[model samples]
Target: MKIALIAHDKKKEELLDFVSKHKDVFSQHELFATGTTGLRVNERTELPIHRFKSGPLGGDQEIGARIANQELDAVFFFRDPLTAQPHEPDVSALIRLGDVYRIPMATNIGMAQILIHAIRRNEF
Candidate 1:
């Protein structure tokens, strides 16, 4: 499976920790992530990741394109909803594209945990 990861600036550390805990499972599949998120995740996990530009710099669009082409199997986007994002449209498109393509998407830590656990159990 090809998993794409994206997280807002404030949620980067959370995403990194999440990936670290689940590295055993995640190591078996391909990983992709936005710039800073990918770098942070790579710092703690051995997963090979394809890093795109920063989200505000078109990384969201890059991931959106992959989703649209059915190149992604799942996405874990840890968004900070309480904060305003300058690239809201791109973020929204990524979510919409995931749904339209029938891909699994987790917008928050709770949902992301569920999906990751399910994957571990081979339920996905």
Candidate 2:
């Protein structure tokens, strides 16, 4: 499965921790992420990840394209809803694409936990 790991600035640490916790499972799949988030996850977890541009610089759209192409199986996007993002429209478009494509997406820790387990169980 091809999994995308993305997070807003405020939620990067949380996503990193989640990745770390599930390194064994994640190691079995291909991983992709936005620039800074990818770098941080790779550095901390030693997981090989394909890195795209920063989100504000078009990373979300890049991932969305992959979704549209049926190249991505799941998305773990840890969004920071409380903060205002300069690339808000891009983010919305990405989420919209996910829904339109019927791609499973996790936008928070709770949803992520469920999705990760489902992946682990080979349920999707």
Candidate 3:
């Protein structure tokens, strides 16, 4: 399965920790992420990930395009809802596209854990 990993600035560390904890599970699949997030995950986990541009610079749109084309199987987006984002519209569009395509997505750590477990069990 192709899995996308994304995190807002404040949530990057949390996402990284989650990914690290699940590195064994994640290592079995293809991973994709936005620029800084991807770089950090790769550096910390040594997981090979395809990196897109920074979200404000079009990464969310890039991921959304994949969702539209049915290329991604799941998305793990650790969004920081309390903060204002400059690319809020793009983020909304990406989430909308995920729903439109019926792709499974997790916007928080709890949901992400469930999704990852589901993937492991071949529930999807």
| Ranking of models by lDDT | 2, 3, 1
| Per-candidate local distance difference test | 0.93, 0.98, 0.96
Q: In model 1, which range of ten residues has the least summed lDDT? A: 39-48
Better of 1 and 2 by TM-score: 2
Clashes per candidate (backbone, < 3 Å):
0, 0, 0
Better of 2 and 3 by TM-score: 2
Model 3 stretches astray by more than 4 angstroms: none
lDDT of 3 by residue, 33-67 (tens): 99999999999999999999999999999999999
TM-score of 1: 0.97
Highest TM-score among the candidates is held by which one?
2
Displacement of residue 89 (Cα, Å) in model 2 is: 0.4
Which residue pairs clash within candidate 3?
A: none
Pairs clashing within candidate 2: none
Q: Write the per-residue lDDT of candidate 2 for residues 1-124, one digit (tens) a residue.
A: 9999999999999999999999999999999999999999999999999999999999999999999999999999999999999999999999999999999999999999999999999998
Q: Which window of 10 residues has the lowest lDDT sum in candidate 2?
A: 115-124
